[model samples]
Target: MNEQNDNAGLFGSGDEAPSNHSNNPHFNDLVAGITRRQILASSAALGSLAFLGATLPSLAEAGEQTVASQPLKRRNRLPFTAIPTSRADTISVPPGYKATPFIPWGTPITGRYPAFADDASNSAQDQAEQTGMHHDGMHFFPIDAQRGLGRQSDHGLLVLNHEYIDAPLLHPNGPTVVNGKRVNAEEVRKEINAHGVSVVEIRRNVRGEWDVVPSPRNRRITAATPMQIRGPARGHKLLQTRYSPDGKATRGTQNNCSNGYTPWGTYLTCEENWAGYFASADADMPRELSRYGLRSSSRFGWNTLPGDEFERFDATRKGASATADYRNEPNHFGWIVEIDPFNPESVPIKRTALGRFAHEGLIFAPAKAGRPLVCYSGDDSQNEYLYKYVSRDRYWPGFSHGRLLDEGTLYVARFNADGSGEWLALDITNPRFLKACLTARVTFADQGEVLINTRLAADVVGATKMDRPEWGAVHPDTGEVYFTLTNNTARTLADAANPRIANAYGHIIRWREQSRDHTGTRFNWDLFLLAGPQTDSRGPDGTALTADNTLASPDGLWFDPDGRLWIQTDMSGSQLSNGPFGNNHMLVADPRSGELKRFLVGPLGAEITGITATPDFRTLFVNIQHPGEGSTATNLLSSWPDGPGKRPRSSTVIITREDGRHIL
Candidate 1:
């Protein structure tokens, strides 16, 4: 969750059409040969479509049929050509673009922290007051009326998540461990403080550059911050802890990855891969613990340190009951935490009905006045399932703060081999689910257990095992949901959907609900893009990806207001040096034309993660995470933002067109 599993660095952080051609006759023939069972089995995978049943069309035909079926609207194309891949230690952008560094790592926000030191010597308190590290999915809340009266480009609140810490870069001596035990409490505290969300006031300067303006809005929600637990799991026994005996609250939100901003003006920062941060000492651990990938030892052994502050990382039962110690500590994380950025003092709420797992991000479906609100999320672990939450209550203008996420039904996706899928409700009352739980030997005591152990429930219900589903995005126009299945090396057998044996280079999969209904259970899905070399065979259509659009380890996906999909890459280790994919970069895709182009590239040892833009589409923001991830303190691989001799600092890049034109 925090780490990219095999790919290092701090952790953080879709679809197309069909075609017609003489060479594509095989695909067309496959489409004609599609049987009812075949259509149901592989309805989600991309291929030629023409099933006798009323299943979703193929990717090639989807765009055509969709355009033909709906009111015609002009699709926007990327204004610039694809930027070539590079090994430069700088950010590459389109020809007419200007990139400015804004709010780099350790930028002080609350004025309590001093100027950021280059030697990684900032104190724990300083870190708590400063901006967090490894900026990921973020959003810009314009400084207009509270509930979004108008867009404010010149001034706004920039809310972002600081994912995992770069231990070597954050500590003076790269984390102290003496005799197989962590000794430095302050270092661990600094790391904890660096793993949450940061809110700061940003304004455009006279020169059209964005500057961090210190204000009361500046605050950091770190690992030690207390947060209220909301939804069905609020007072559950599994959530009770010594810190919050009533089970109403708990400390911290770590591994905050991609985020979601609500129409009601709140920031939803998701907790991903948080299980790796804890160490469970007991062999007979809670069944939910191992299911979430919690283990006996962690990369940062906070449990080995002294004091209750550090001991909370030991999730094993230390006392007789859950409230006696930190047995329920891990349960507090792996949730979508909602924070009111406009009101700095507002307490963050862990929305537990979102179904806890390694949540990559949450992308809300387009809001409708009288329709139930829907939020889509993906579990980032290898072979994990995709999930979505549908609120029981309908959306209205200026609804209550936590009403949407509080009372909702959480569902896990089950993609049939034929490209069709159904959202399996996690509710135990469903008869089919009861039999599934019985088969898995999992007895659901209540709804809380079903939510706390959501992945287990998903497995019991036979959800599809994907290739490490990561970031997700909802098309503003098409109402299609896209998720990046960012590589899975552990996979051995090649399935009909995920066809690769050892899927090092990942792919993007997308789905569209019937009648564009986000709350609907049944839908059609298909592979949008396969991330790999140009020479790689195009599986079904065999012409979807090419040299100009090929990419590996697709992550950090977003759709700008104009419907341009932005893709960020995460390739590390030999993938960088051995192939044309050198360093991480960002790409832009046009859904209607099925055209993708490389828009920007980052410096050495960096993964381009977070991405956001103003409502007017003038100002764009992207994050450069862990610019020198694999390098040692003495010998660095990249020294970006500050230039060559300086230590590499992760920073956010602010971009705008020099010609003052719209981004598309």
Candidate 2:
């Protein structure tokens, strides 16, 4: 999640300005009109209770009432006790809850099912068959019709995103390098094979423990997998690479972070920090490449090796046209890739209509029959923009396909000081956008080019430049959208929306769509929580964040069916400085009462991300990523899951109640 510095891309130079919002005169006037005190007072007055009451549709109007809106027959308070902060290298949960490690990195799931080696000597082919590294966003699809059971929780397919890898921990003695270039071809191949998605069959055994079940459905989609490019920018000239002269295809999805699922049961894996993986020495790089932070060298020196497959990482213009070389390769990476987990033979499609720019993740609003589909995504860089897409065609139950994502109008948000916000259409035909582009002297060949340069388009239109926006969640009952602004130390201007200067401790902001319409262009927003030390932080009620609920750098966010907001943190850079916050952890918050409680804490140097649950909500799955992240081959900082003397591995943890009841 761009855990490096506020200005830098995950592994690239921070060449772009921290924020242009302060420079826009109109934006300045919007913020200058409202005082911070007024903003906070208005937000507190519209507390959680008021928020729920005002935004929720009537039961009859909404058709069916979710479990969250039912009367007092259900438990009203949070069931578990809040745990204290800890620094110990272990998983900590509240009393009556059990957390078990499962599907760790390098565990075999497909092909011959090779066993994990403690010394990390597995081959590149072995890695392609095994579970990938750094598990992020995931979903559990129940095995219902196959087992003749409706919404079965015991058996399911676990689909998760394997984000970027920890190179030092991947090999036995670490990567081999001669000079500044990577020399070991096998190491490079294995690293590329580890970055993508994994689909595995898992089931609960009679002994009440979850285990990977050998099945034909098990598969791994790595960075080298062939994928089709779809949507408005599908066959654009800018995307024409040597491998795909027609610009309709590309090789691989990299840096997959948080994910989403479609109503038709497809998985959406987002490619984040992908621009840093490409290098170009071209003097006159286009906006499509330069705007996304392309550097002179790549994070992993895969481009240093000889061969078209490895050399594609070097995007320099060495050919007469875009199709003659890999100059257009970077355009293929930063997209929301749609994967059909049920169909192993299906090719993943990169839905380019979503307007990619280091997409952190995508979250869909609840689909309704005969209504246009709506989804939201955020750019995960300092001073980047937030985006939403509305489909041109109406959605039909059991009939909708990925085509809905292909034909859509993308919009960028502009939050104002008066708590009102507008979604400015990023369409090339929009008069305001066209004027802005002309004024900035930015020319686009077509809608495809506009989508290719989404960040630049948003810049000309003057979208609100947010902090490092990471993950987003949609409340099942109220339809309120919540996004985590994972800390931005680069922020220097204080506005009503982003109310802090040098915001090291991130905050959560939420908004309800206008008139409860998911496709509405106007909305109202408020700060849900300002995370930091007890003295500086504030909750929804304007009270100080206590030791029990304080946190920093909120990253992953999700909403259970019961309306509980699950919050995860990635305090990698500040964990030592913010000692009181302890190790990375996950917490649950009651949106109705603005009450928060710490639920789970991971081992030292790990990030708590990628959360999901079974259909019955009886079992919960959470990922502990990059434990002991900065450790070297000889100087180990942590030995988690396997204890002392063993290398640390990223793994998923299963949480369940002691009494076998539903986990709340």
Candidate 3:
């Protein structure tokens, strides 16, 4: 989900820092009187005006080590600091509170047409009228019909997750290709309908309100949107692309990245760096080129250039068969999608019984009438494997009550270094590993090639390989799940769920579940935080540590509605891309006091992607993206969430705690 880089924004240093930690003045006078009772009432009058302006903080609502034992510091804390470069476009919180843009980057949407013009000419209906650009992992579903309620909120259903696009500020003078091919099939169908998922519906206005309700039931699910792949790598033949010649509808849903929702509400999303946007030629099929992991998909020159939407991402076959040319458009793209963000007519279903790699997040587990509802996923690649599906039916919480997300039963994941792990079942009852609908080798016409070769049948059943895993949350109070192994520069040579070798910085595994507390068959784990930098560097037994508990590449991860967790950096290794681990920051962990801070640091060439909160844990969004990518969008490097001459636009900001507390 990062490469073409540069959305610009770093207006050569100016300076200005000292506000936001509730931007003080009495924590912005208590989130300005409880968000002005959320724009003047109507979530049961803002839960009776937050139980008449909810007082009773007992240490700001005990969570995250009670907001990390209250001493926050940082008016210039670590030897680390930066954001002053005239604070371009502005958004530097931590002092007392204040962050706005709950969503930006061609904003407005309600079905279609409004965003276009950073020089214009983008259509696929300006990607359902815009709101997709590196957003990443979100969740706010609190229309609270009250069930364990107390943290009152006004309106909800945010979803959000774009995860890709910058192609020279998204068109008008960039992304054309014209000769090596790809002269913009309508700017690659407006950058694959500005990559997937949107949902918006937030509320609470009238001075005590939430935001984003652009209306007409605002919705969008791009990358062409039109799913239904469901399990066992649907029609395998590696997801046969070229516009579903036989892959069963799959127009789009690129890099998606983190997101989850179920309990019967449905939303899932996920799809990390989706096999580097295709380039493949690694000598015409080196085993479908090392079975669908494409070591070079992001050369971003868009397959020779000029169109048929970037020459169907070169899957070879060069013509004569597979129903002539366009070699099945990169097997439709890494799976997991799901949507139905509250059924806006619904249709986003890639579930393929959930098994595609590069995915990154999918949580869900607490469902147990008769058992088998489990979910947990992660395969963000690099050493892959750590999936789970289990759902041969049992959860009837509303039993798909408004269109249940198609039956379930997908599995693949093994992890066991005595640490213990096992789920397996990519099923067909495993006739020699994922084979099933064998109408003579046409294999699995149903569970979609078992979630599309679910990482080649978890490498034909063995499973385990990790490191790069990215997001996964849960523990709405001990249902425990936590994930983020995010950095593993290919550890050990032994294969199978990472046997252990030069792993680099990464570690944060978690577990717990023996019988339906979000059951993934059986659970119980450990080894929580271990990113890197305490010393040794990479070893004399090197575990390294400290950047306030050092963190190398731990990509976008969340866990808010008060269970804490946050994290965010992509670090880029080589000592944070160019010395002294500068940009990319968001940290805040505390999984029961293993502590670790940082709280916010993103600017000069950003990377701290997505975070989400707002279920009354009062605001907290996140998502910086592209800041100063490949440089020069007019000499930018990061004006941050808003700064500089205005070019960097991978928006989403929110953040709160200077006194409205509760931000461990």
Candidate 4:
């Protein structure tokens, strides 16, 4: 979902400080225990056992197995053949699998909403009453069986994020641009309503087929929905505006990309790439705002609609102070929003302790009693930093999630060249960080300021800049963290870590914390997969990719309970049309051997994203976004998931095994 840009901007320019040797004896001791040698030896022995015809436990029984406190027991190899790359305008799953197109854009969730019109003429109010567009990251929260029984995966709430809008195809004739400005106010409103999260009640019928149930639980949290601002930045001066003078609340959450689910039953939709939607007219704008690429003109020109409500997109100083106008609207976004899927009346809360950046997603580490909850997030921008947040309070059997996220310490990663890394604290109380902020021309007035300008704080502390870090996933069995570095076209210089110059096809990196501790500040990392075209050079680790395994611009990542790593592609430009990477596909990889197998290929001009499986692992859901995005009305590349001649709509595809067996 990243748009390429030159690295000359404030957020992308500087090189991070070289990694320093660790002086902490405790950190050094933790790294020595599970050295590379020990892990490699364990992997080699496990591979030999598998080769000798050893049968591992079934994936369905993995939950009953007692996971080791240290490295987890290896699972069996993935049992599906690799689906070939194709340019077809339909989803192609494995031989024994079936995919059903369920709940596309504009599907009505309430009685007041009208059915989807084929002419693409749904009004703004119609969009608010119907399902939102562009389904991205999603989670299926299983409804508990009656009388306190376990999860009922057959029925639950399906909450998915509508990342952004396909404006041309959404409106009737197209977006109305008159004299370089948007003049159609109704068109802009429809676009706005289409850019948030949607919660729908879904149920599995007697035939085991799933569809929308259309119950009262169905709800849409659009761009106009009211939301409360919480955590460290709740009442910060930078977040104050005419909309909320106390800075404790705001209007809505938009541009939600990837997502996370809490143990206590809540959905966490992350805001990403929100900077391009704002405008600031003043010449002397805030340095932090400029750093994030907020300019005088937005990509959509929503502020040109000639009203104070529409002008809220203008984030510059006006009328003398912040409260006099909507000068701080941009600051209120770029956060992880928590929504209670079970309670339709509950208001969404913006958890500000997670820091403000283009948050790709948050993947929680395995929670343990007496230990602070830990989660990993990535800033999905070029040359951005990886972040980890440690809750201030230790987790108990029934701890409150809001309290856990409200107070925590956010840390930015500093990867050393010697295979080690340190988590630099973003807390202003640290004297070393305080001195670094002064040198970077940023003043840490308070902890709220530290979080508002998160990129600046990371820069001052010398955090390692990464290639566009996207979706992250935590191993269901092991505590290892894996994230996709989706691609960085602006990188001209090479290093041992980011070895490719102009790296179009990216890589995945995995790391383990000290002593399997989620809240520990030290870690050991290594490149998991270095992806590229077939003719491209092999990775430094001597891993070669062939046509069957070639993939470009890996974006969405997830780990099913069966310990399978699901990788989704987002190939762009000439690469999509020229290489082995045909229309974006989903691939499954073994974390131990890096053995990859293509699982499915999506429709033409669509990116395969939003991977989630039912608790039973029998039904899997995948989203097809922006189909026919590169085509014109007269020359459509695809009208798939519907039929020919019908306008292509972004929708969710439910996949399962035809024989009632578990999907591999």
Top-scoring candidate (lDDT): 2
Which candidate order results from sorting by TM-score in descending order?
Answer: 2, 1, 4, 3
Which candidate, 1 or 3, has the higher TM-score?
1
Give the runs in model 4 whose Cα sits over 4 Å from its true position: 3-76, 145-150, 537-542
Query: For model 2, what is the error of residue 160's alpha carbon versus the real structure, in angstroms, after optimal superposition?
Result: 0.6
Give stretches of model 2 more than 4 Å off: 5-32, 42-74, 145-150, 495-499
Give residue 112's lDDT in candidate 1 (0 to 100).
73
Total clashing pairs for each candidate: 18, 0, 94, 0
TM-scores for every candidate against the unseen true structure: 0.90, 0.93, 0.32, 0.89
Instruction: Give each model's whole-structure lDDT.
Output: 0.77, 0.83, 0.56, 0.78
Per-residue alpha-carbon lDDT of candidate 3 for residues 585-664, written as tens digits (9 for 90 to 100): 76665443333566676655666676666555666667776666644455555555445555666767766654655444
Candidate 4 lDDT (Cα, 0 to 1):
0.78
Kindly list the per-residue Cα lDDT of model 4 for residues 518-602, writing each as its tens digit. 7778886766667887675333224467766788888999998867789998876676667678889998886544467889999
lDDT per residue (tens digit) for residues 150-216 in model 1:
4777899889998887777787657777886788788888989988999988998898778888799
lDDT of 2 by residue, 1-664 (tens): 6455443322323223342333443333466666555444423322353322145432223443356854333245577889999888999999999999999999999999988888899999999999999999898888752321248899988999998887878899988878878888999999999989999989999998899999988999999999999999989999999999999999999899999888777889998888778889998887788878777877777898998889899999998998899999998878999998878899999999999788889999988889999999998887777899999999987788899999989999898776788899999888988998898887888899989988888888888877777899999988889999888886677765456678788898888888555898888776788898898787766678888898999999999988889999988666643578999999998776567899998898898999999989999999999888776679778899898988899999999999999997
* Minimal lDDT window, size 10, model 4: 45-54
